[model samples]
Target chain A: MTEKLRIVQMGLGPIGNKVTQYLAERPNLEIVGAIDTDPAKVGQDVGVLAGLAPLGVIVTADIDAALGGGRADVVVLTTASSMAKVHDQLLRILPYGVSVVSSCEELSYPWQTQPELAASIDRAAKKSNAAVLATGVNPGFLMDFLPAAMTGVCRKVRKVTVERIQDATFRRIPFQKKIGAGLTVEEFYKKVEEGVLRHVGLTESMHLIAARLGWQLDKTEDIITPIIAERRVTTDSMVIEAGNVLGVQQLGRGIMGGEEVISLVFRAAIGEPGARDRIVIDGEPAIDSCINGGVNGDVATCAILVNAIPVVAKARPGLRTMADIEPITCW
Target chain B: MTEKLRIVQMGLGPIGNKVTQYLAERPNLEIVGAIDTDPAKVGQDVGVLAGLAPLGVIVTADIDAALGGGRADVVVLTTASSMAKVHDQLLRILPYGVSVVSSCEELSYPWQTQPELAASIDRAAKKSNAAVLATGVNPGFLMDFLPAAMTGVCRKVRKVTVERIQDATFRRIPFQKKIGAGLTVEEFYKKVEEGVLRHVGLTESMHLIAARLGWQLDKTEDIITPIIAERRVTTDSMVIEAGNVLGVQQLGRGIMGGEEVISLVFRAAIGEPGARDRIVIDGEPAIDSCINGGVNGDVATCAILVNAIPVVAKARPGLRTMADIEPITCW
Candidate 1:
């Protein structure tokens, strides 16, 4: 533990590059290898690709080439959103006995939603004696884990409610487009039908909250609707005429005994006013907490992935949740 | 794990009684025994003493009788505030192989300040294969652990600042007097010299934050001053003159490389305006968070003690800090 910890960066996407940038600044960490399936990313210096000075380490598509030396202590994974998609990538890395901190949304709490895959991953991680954790700003921290942690000061929690409102004007182009920032009402519904418009992790966040509170929810529901533009909204990239869709309004509910005990509301709009994050816990000594101006989503996801490295490195070998590992902090 | 968890209530003070009341409401727990040193409380039923119906469990002065049956899984200890005072009680209970969740403040993070005592407790607990944790609202949750947890979304934290302000008018009489609500300037200075009218755990909280961030601090300092009343302040208990002391303002600092990196300010005064808890993390993607109308001190301490029961029960056999165990939630 006296020596600098070695790390491998996998997936050269937006979030992955941000994680690499943060990891590069840490004096206690050394980037030993980089992996990306993109042909353009392969053979390029990871540091330069992430908008930093070249570090002489080239990105390769082969997992073995990056992990073969067995010098890497942990892997920063930012590959996919679904557990099924990242299943093989996890299996490939867990055998190397290197802990992983991933940004996969569903993997944040996959045990309830994808039990079989989670169990398999757990078994594989146990066999290799390596820990795996999936975390990000939304599912990993803000909506679920933070609210659950807040209950530590409560005697009996009757209900938990959270709201995340984001102003999408300054977000990345990809994020803005993903949220349907400038779309017609009809097109938004069509995209929703195609199952690609809404945000991931609301259901996962709900389950994580329930698990932390020891609540047995009878059922869960997620509703996605459009936040119609009342006036013309303009961003750096595009403009939305009045009566068009500005962004999305997503509401997720966790029910027990036909009562909605947990409610999470997410809103991201180009002209959204009062961007903030709020949590209200109805219990003895009730709490009303707010993070003014909200947490920056993209930047925070990178931070969560980077800060969780040491926690995963020391965690017991298993498929872990944010609740399973030690509390994460800035490194 | 299938059977109900048996619990022993130790130290029948205000907090201890509140813990007992909360534990009695849970269907998954059973009150197995109770222990107290007060002569009048020694022969009383635990439930009745806590302002609840009789549960047939009498309070005993002997620790052996409360923990001897081998059925008790955890002990809810609401005893002294200092490590030296509670050292014997911890040693006596750890040997019984029953886990303990205590409200002792200094035990929250004793590694840096009280290394020998912490090591002794760790050794004793390890020998008996039992886990011990110290937690409450201030040292345990709000100041140290909450700030650390908030940094999970931060990339590089330059500074950590926390403020806990309370309005003493609604608080208990003991709490009001503890903060020197009606003391004059002369009396306040005398009490300060006597070292009796100050808060504990601020230094411990600073150290815990430093440990979580992996900062090697150069030195630490704590200062206490009085907040004088500009206008006569009145409370249910008493009234203070315009020039009299309203309450004490305590500040704790963690300095690194001659820079103040961690600062904690605590204020509890009668008629304090805008009581709140606020934390600011100066770093990449800086965060400013607040709990509107600060968390209640006494009630929250009771909640933290009861909520941490399941976490300690499953932790590894040793003296555990809030950072070592799983994230606590309402359970």
Candidate 2:
């Protein structure tokens, strides 16, 4: 595996940059090329685009040409949720038998909800005789890995809850817009009515959890809050309006029997941020796990993806979300 | 369509009594009998048991006799969340073709999260040639009905969010316990860890919305906060302990896509109780609707339910939750 694992990076954004930084340290991994929709960075080096100075590798808007370079082995995805739109690019490269590992949050919770995309990715990957693995640190590990860790002491393990509260303004601009900051109550209400301004990523967090538990989530409910701080507050340097906020807190749960639910709680805030999470299990070997920063949701997610690379590479050639990947002993 | 609908009132909890009171005033409905788990209530008048004085109806725990009496056409359920146990009574009579309406919160969201329970109810109802309609004025109607009603104005419905807040101590004690009042942070942690203390009805709330739009939900999550008054906070002649909370605020959400979520936010707090809701959509048509209340949530819930009765009775039923029922014309 150390024979230079040539990688292709897509979606020139924050997490994409982080992925590049982490993979740069790996002796076996080599980023062969990169692609993005932004015209400003098209002819620049991948490292320069990632803000880590310049690497010899050039960025290209032409996805086909990037794949046509023919040096790439695996496509490392950081594309947005609609990464599904890159299906044609995925197909073109998969025929060349290039496997994939992406930062697409949707991959963690793929099977039960995103059946269409999962099926498409699988079909394309199999046709090319390569595997596709998707993941991230938040929905990938923070929501999933920690809960999976709790099962060690839990015997009947009924439910697990994960909460993530982050300042979206500091992480990315799109997220700030996604949370609808600066919008009046009426404007926020309008977006929820149309279903457009709703924040993304957490759904996959819940999906990762349910799939890890091997259940089809019989029922689920949520509340996306665009709360107006009755008392004005600020996070970092952003002065969030006293009555308007982009902060979002949501809950996702899976019920198994009668009224017993396997639950997960998620909250992401742009203005005032405090992070916390807890998970409980019942009936024999009842267990509870709590963490202030939510059990390494960040660094561990990167690890999860890197670790999965080996497992996915050896698996059957097809599109595989975290669910399709069998559990491997990290030890 | 009423023809003096004969109904059996089962359970005499706070919610049960409210339904009984509602039934008392409706000239088109007749309370044939009442059932309680407590033997002390047996042979007592329902009005007395319901705190409304004698109304000529006897309260009995004989579930079999109530179904066998053949005097009622529908079973108004107000039992615990364990409907599998309470549903037995409905099934015994279901074979005789009697319909049901209940405050069984999970029933509204069961098909997605609790398919087993939903399927069983559907099967029993089908065998009996009857219908099962489960609702709550708050969890069912307020959380589900209002958002669905506004969907008419949404062009591409991306997300839906609902928030409900009420003072439970002023409303009911069980709700306070259910929300984790009168406990330390450790105790609250214990309950949430055991999968017993978190919000129960939000999953149904998500299912209600999903069923309405024919959207498949992959994730549902929750966040529960135990509210306690500390150091001589006086409210209406009550001095509460620092850790002895009176209610809880729970937020639950469901994500349809990575960025699109249908969220339900609920609060049952005696400490500081008020509700303000706002929704955000990315489409052309959007909205903002909110209600402030000095009374218990049940008061508003009852109104929401009464408004939806016509919609439920007229609609086709296969395990109907609020979202399955047509939008309430006015609330």
Candidate 3:
């Protein structure tokens, strides 16, 4: 909107790579730099890394340099949701009063889930008088905006529930490992004991929704057990043994005032076939929407962040979470 | 299991009264005592309050005597979810090592949403070597159990959404007031400001869900506004002003990892007709269930609580939420 905005893209992961591709053609947007921990590819041409045309952009871990020297106008982070590291990178640009948009789950329930990290980000954002916005597809768009938008069709609501099912064999490799793709039940239990193997994004989505909606989600719970395929299967190049590879299934439920209001479920594996999502509303003029596959989740989330840059840029600067405002429209 | 389990029913509200009636003639359960805040009904017989045969159970607000001096084995709390003070009552019954279950939303998210209260109650329960469980119809049965059971059907999944809607004019009074039924847009906003009116519940549901499912919901938001009637209508007792006295529609969404996994929405109002709820899953073996609202969710939550006592009573300690234990049979 203002003479071709400069932006920094973080992480060279699948979504990050996809984001670069999406942003490549936008005349008003320019990639000043890129960040990733892939040591082998550091200092490599980001355009080639993102599978796009030559843009002269290089992937580097030098977040500070990317923030300063007028390297970029805004920082677009698509890193891990725990991205407390993003907070540090965000600070370097904040003092310059630069705006930041991220696909970080940490920003949603920053206080309750990550209080210290959230407080630090908040302090830095306020001190620099720069704007910060966190959003993404699953945690950003559908969880927060789709439901809010659905209220338009109903007259009265007694309860609301959200259900999502995903098959991640089509997703990138890292996601497969992250969700425990080739693990036995015994190994899965071991990982659970160590508290490291599991899905990572949906929890933040719930936080964003609750804060905006003003319902007190008093209790939440999830049951995670790896789902190994009943039959042997193989992926693009990998052979998933009959019971060696995980046919993962994860389901989480939430209760408010002793009543269950929401459920978050995900399943991913190497040989899984397809994916689907559905929503049902129980009011006058009841509504239901069921769709197939991932359906622009992360892409939509990227759009939400890019579109909301203007809104955050206009609003007051501070450590703002979903609780501080509504599931606003970027338009 | 133990001679019709002497059960003490608390808060003789509409829900409490209905649950008492629902279980009135059951041979395995007995109403031993009752509690309420109303002074007028303080000494009245519980059976007479529900217009049933006299069981000689008297209602009182004195929680101490109600559970102290070796009284009932378990206390069924159906008090208002807004009463944070009542949660403290949950801790008192435990010193006698008396197991307790409540329909309190506060107890559901006591640790995350209301940590201080959850901690204090946790300490109280620890001192008493007792266990506590909370649940209800929507947040309890449908949101928590139905989805958990649906896990058996899916081999792989990507996202999930749940929905519930009910007409409030057909519902009881407390629900209408709490959901801000029959109000204009300006009036609804005013109530949200007053903190006296709210959609109630979903927040805790989302919170518990994220924690239990092992995904980190870093950001969440709610989309709620006013729902005016499209046309003029009249209810059994209340007059409609065309666009007034209809009800409010609400939605809450939770997303994880840049993908929308859980989408929850519902409708509820009294001025209209009947109430209904449904669950729709999106996996290879998808699920769909629509239930009529005859279960009386308010009281059914209490039933959910009482029903869970069997499993929770035997569960390990240290702040165990719903997913921590196996699903107990209440049907």
Assess each prediction's global lDDT (C-alpha) against the native. Answer: 0.91, 0.62, 0.62
Which residue pairs collide in model 1, if any?
A: none
lDDT of 3 by residue, B1-331 (tens): 5456667888788777866765565566777778887998899988888889877888888877776777576667777675376666665566767666777765665556778777777777777666676766656545544444333223233455667777677666667767766677678778878866655666666665555443467655666666677766666655656566466666767777777666667666654454555556664334454544423555445445655654455544534455444334321
Segments in model 2 whose C-alpha atoms lie over 4 Å from true places: A1-331, B167-178, B194-196, B227-232, B237-246, B277-282, B302-314, B327-331
lDDT of 3: 0.62
Stronger candidate by DockQ (1 vs 3): 1
Model 1 stretches astray by more than 4 angstroms:
none
User: In model 2 chain B, which range of ten residues has the least summed lDDT?
Assistant: B278-287
In every candidate, what fraction of the native interface contacts is reproduced? 0.89, 0.00, 0.00
In terms of docking quality, how is candidate 2 classified? incorrect
Order of candidate numbers by lDDT, starting with the best: 1, 3, 2
- In order of listing, the candidates' clash counts read 0, 38, 97
TM-score of each: 0.98, 0.47, 0.49
Candidate 1 per-residue lDDT over residues B213-318, each given as its tens digit: 9999898898999889998877777989999988889999999999999999999988888899999999878999999899988779988888888888988889
lDDT of 2 by residue, B1-331 (tens): 4377777888788777877876777566678888887877789999877778689998888777877747877777778766667567566657756777776666656777767777888888777666677765556555665455334323235667776666554545566667776666778778888978866677677666676555677777777777666654444535557766656668777776665477676776666555434333323233344433422345444433333344444445456655444333221
